[model samples]
Target: MEFRLIDRIRERTVLARGDVRLGIGDDAALLVPPAGQELAVAIDTLVEGVHFPHGTPPRDIGWKGLAVNLSDLAAMGATPAWALLALTLPRANAACVDGLADGFAQLAQEHAVALVGGDTTRGPFCLSIVVHGFVPPGQALTRAGARAGDAVFVTGTLGGAAGGLRLVQGRLPFDPADEAHRALRARLDRPTPRVRAGLALRGHASACIDVSDGLLADLGHLCAASGVGAQIDPNALPVPSALRGVFGSAAARELALSGGDDYELCFTVPPADVGAMQAALAAVDGKATRIGTIVEGQGVRALGNEPLAAARGGWDHFGL
Candidate 1:
């Protein structure tokens, strides 16, 4: 059967707000802030099982929901300003909901993001967040502007999250006393988004996208959208020091390139601005390493020039 449920929903539910210059279409929903201001927007969702395991920490769930939305705004090179939250719970537990709200409030306070409004409803456990921010006009980094010959770069190390997941599931043999294991486990619980580095790369980056869908998959997104391809050097991926001991070199490399939920920034910059970009990243105590180069093609290639396979076919709403 052929169905257009999504299209129907878009047609019916798309509300036209005065501030929304464009919505429900295009690469992103666009809004025009007051004159001399900028526009920033982000979307994130938390599902029952996919985002959080059963009986997961409520505080962490709250923190992660806000964090992921902020990560999206960060990817657009915007300074987060406001947020709207929506929640659907099968049965509301006052304590659990309060703890979640506390987590959200704390992070919002730290980032100076105001929670202006929200809605609550009854359904399966799910939470959605939309954050807004601002940047200089014509300065937002996007996935559509990358050009061939641009250098690809990623911030911080990778693979820690995947390693952490393994530890949580008891899938990896590890000593409880090992500091490495402890660190990787923490990474899975809390991920730091590269908001500062993304803002710094604004003018320098020809195209940008957060590493939410693994390095290779996200880079492929940049390529497909920009009409370009990339050659990623396997050796160039920065795997966290702690993860190396637990997973070894080959496994670490795979995780770094294919693992999702890193929440880091992967962007392309012009060769000449490399120094400035590096300098800017340094302010945030973040490191940027060039891992590949953009070329005229349609997908991403890994080392030895082989096409990189999608890890779990990227993050999908339904299932992999």
Candidate 2:
């Protein structure tokens, strides 16, 4: 079946009050940021063969391109506002592009964000989304604020995506008939960025970052950027029930600790602010579990004061 861009948008897009002005067919979209809010901007690129496996669904690619950028905005506690899309396609196929646009519009409507500007180019299939958001000045979260003795926390579970990826590649023995396997595959295909949780933790978290890389690697980043070290309890890392069968016990722990692309939030808050942080995140139905504490050292250490080792391999731009 062929899908037209405008038709797909009208069929799938849900308009929001803040998503004012014109839409897809207009020469350009017009958006007005709410009063007294500083604009937060982030851009992300997804190359078909590089960022995702070849022939991945166009809808998912569109959603993820925007989702990852939104995750960056979430880390800064920004309220999403506008987006600009830059699409590169090898061919001028309307159906494929429309399917992608449909995915993008679906997410934009759900988050009350609007598509303002973008470009279309000819190349191997690739997507770049530049997302815009708003935050009150002086309240945007950053990685520079974490201090020694602060508690580090993460929302939701980890490792399921990595395990799910393995399943998708036919490397794991997941039963396609099983509902749980399907769910795991879905998680890997389309991750839920914890935008609400990040927004809620804005004033409370001293430092924050979304877990794009594995937990240990990403936390190490926060520590390095903030000039501190961290000690994470292995047991505290959340692993979903569905992943247990796929990765087993020890392997699951490793995946939870080092698996990347979960897109969950990993942040630090002062001990005194813990209660308030918990209360704020509760509204989103997400729990902020204390997994580690910042220290004056140079790197991350595990529960036994030993350097944390990745159960799986680290993410490398070059060949792994």
Candidate 3:
């Protein structure tokens, strides 16, 4: 059963990449990395309800499982090359496996990333993906390079995913088929990792992070790592129209400030390079909004010199 289930996925997601010497049939697939480039690898696991909602489509789950890990690589200015999918099922549902493989394959094709190899097992319903990418040596972005005078920027509008989850959970009222609902739901389910933006920011951004744990939470991490502080002006926050429409003004602001799962890139660039960075990103149809500035302090704060409390703002895996 396990072998057949693995075959179900292997059939749907096979891709031919020249760098792949061997793929998906043997005990271990082999690969050759591009010469003169450093490898960037990241992995993530999603359970039934922790990373995604219960009853969500298997297709979206498969796409998101890989997308989130790609977002991590994106944060480091990596170009995706290959992936390994480890899918488990409570029961062997071939249809669900097909849907999941198709979804994962769809995004992998977009980035030209091939599925090299992975394992299958009988366990709780979960999906795990390990992705590998390459970046120019000494050019990868990290959280420790942000300087005190750097400008903090984020790609895409904030809080749409959280708003989408609200819509899904019935906390917000909206028609399921409406354009507004679909947009928000798409943000939550099919998040576009800012790979292009990350690639573009390589030469300019001093620090970068993908906003998986909310802006404040993730930025605070960047600041802490760099030993700097940040001041975010609420007026500069970029709230998605869909998120605002579903959440209204006040709630939208709150959501934009601290809602997680958006998968957008939050990065810091030197003040003098901000214009060039924004222009480069804009050329790719990527919206880079400057909301804050790094300062010589301990943590993050909003306007009027108030500390941005960490408690109710971001997603903490095991918090109160």
- For every model shown, what is its TM-score relative to the native structure? 0.85, 0.90, 0.96
| Candidates by lDDT, descending order | 3, 2, 1
Off by over 4 Å in 2: 1-30, 311-320
Question: lDDT, candidate 3, residue 181?
Answer: 93
Which should have the higher TM-score, number 1 or number 2? 2
Cα distance off (Å), candidate 1, residue 128: 0.3
Which ten-residue region of model 1 has the weakest summed lDDT?
Answer: 1-10
Assess candidate 2 and give its lDDT: 0.80
Model 2 / residue 122 / CA error / Å: 1.4
- Residue 211 local lDDT, model 3: 93
- Reference-based lDDT, each prediction: 0.76, 0.80, 0.88
Ranking by TM-score: 3, 2, 1
lDDT of 3: 0.88
Clashing pairs in 3: none
- RMSD (Å) of each candidate, 1 decimal: 7.9, 3.2, 1.5
